[model samples]
Target: MTTQTDLIQYLLRLGDSALIQGQRLCQWCGRAPALEEELALMNVGLDLVGQARNWLDYAAELLDDGRDADHLAFRRDERAYRNLLLVEQPNGDYAVTMLKQFFYDAWHLEVLQGLSRSSDERIAGIAAKAVKEATYHLRRSGEWVERLGDGTEESHQRMLDAIPLLWRFTIELISGDDSETRLHAAGLVPDAAQIASAWQARVEQVFTRATLPLPAAPSYFYLDARRGLHSEHLGTLLAEMQFLPRAYPDATW
Candidate 1:
């Protein structure tokens, strides 16, 4: 049986991924490679933030606690966060950011599609709406992946280098934990192994067209249990993102 605790945790994981990823993209303010790219990332980042709010709001309901989406986003300890190591990775360069988004958005699309069929109404509703957004996100990021990988020598080489480094994190995105497993068995979540296969196909299909070398094999760095573990970067990101809320708990517009 999938307990409410399990559902809340899973929802937190979903929300955290979006919130953290959104913060990462927001970092590109006036920093993207071009004006158009800057605007694109910004809009995409905002979209993720919006998605986070929906997930977190439902998480709050399942929690049956007083905290809301804002609290979950701003008040949680670093250890409580469930975002993937991939989303939390530093946006090293344009290549790094786009590849990361491509990988995540691709997986997100499949997951959302599965979630759209969830037995739970709120979960299903959120997933149904999110699937459309994830589809667009995947397309945008995938387009950039092809462009960078097949572009100029300098751009192509940069993307080539980014692939190996980013590949390690991809493993974790499709691999779920006990919480996810229970929910999945209850038909509250998707089959991660199945999704893993689809994710691989889509990712490989894109890489094939871009003529980029595919990353191979099991990654030790993905860390089998991601529930309570995170990279060093997440803490620094939280400090900045949570600053306003933490410093002024009562502030409002």
Candidate 2:
């Protein structure tokens, strides 16, 4: 059986991943190389932020501590965030950002698909709604991966370099903890191992279409974000994300 603490932690992890990745995506606002791509990135960022709000609000309800989504999102310290390291990595370039999104969106689609059938009704509902959005995200990122991978000699090279760099971070997406194991046993969550297979298949299909070679797996670097350990990039991200909230302190816009 999954404890309330475990559930709350799990929800927070979900929220944090979306929130931080949304923030990272938003950095590309008005800066994308093309107008269409700029709007696409912005739209996806908003979708992720919307998902983050729902998950964070649900997490607050589970905690029953009087805090709201905003508190858990913008007011939390770096060590309090449960997001994985990949989401917090600096958006190096367009290729880097798109590669990151491609990897994450593939994993997210599989996870959300499984969650859509969860025994927990609330989780199932959220997953059902989120999977639709995630599907669009995957499509958009996949399109870009193909364009960049098969375009020009320079574009293909950049995309190729991004593959190995981003692949290193892909392992943890389907890696689970004791809480995940219990949830799986209870039918409240999908088996991480199963989700990994789906993720792998999806990735392989996309890579084949893009004509990009898959990189061999590297030594896994585990960061215990569930226990509040985070990458250094998170501090800068938090400082910017929390600046307005910290300055305004309860004042509404």
TM-score of each: 0.96, 0.96
Q: For model 2, what is the error of residue 212's alpha carbon versus the real structure, in angstroms, after optimal superposition?
A: 1.6
lDDT of 2 by residue, 1-253 (tens): 3467778887888889999999999999888999998888889999999999988999999889889999999888999998877789888888889989988898888888998998999999999999999999999998888888888999899998887766766767757779888878888878989988888888788888888987765446756777787778999989999999999997996
Model 1: pairs clashing at backbone N, Cα or C within 3 Å: none
RMSD of each: 1.4, 1.4
Q: How does each model score on lDDT?
A: 0.88, 0.86
Alpha carbon deviation, residue 182, candidate 1 (Å): 1.7
Residue 217 lDDT, candidate 1, scale 0-100:
52
CA lDDT for candidate 2? 0.86
**Which lDDT value does model 1 have at 16?**
91
The true-versus-predicted C-alpha distance at residue 115 of model 2, in Å, is 0.8
Query: How would you encode candidate 1's per-residue C-alpha lDDT over 1-253 as one tens digit per residue?
Result: 3478888888888899999999999999988879998898888899999999999999987787799999999999898998878899999989999999999998889999999999998999999998888888999999999999999999899999898778887878767677778888888989998889999999889999888988775466635325668888898999999999999999997
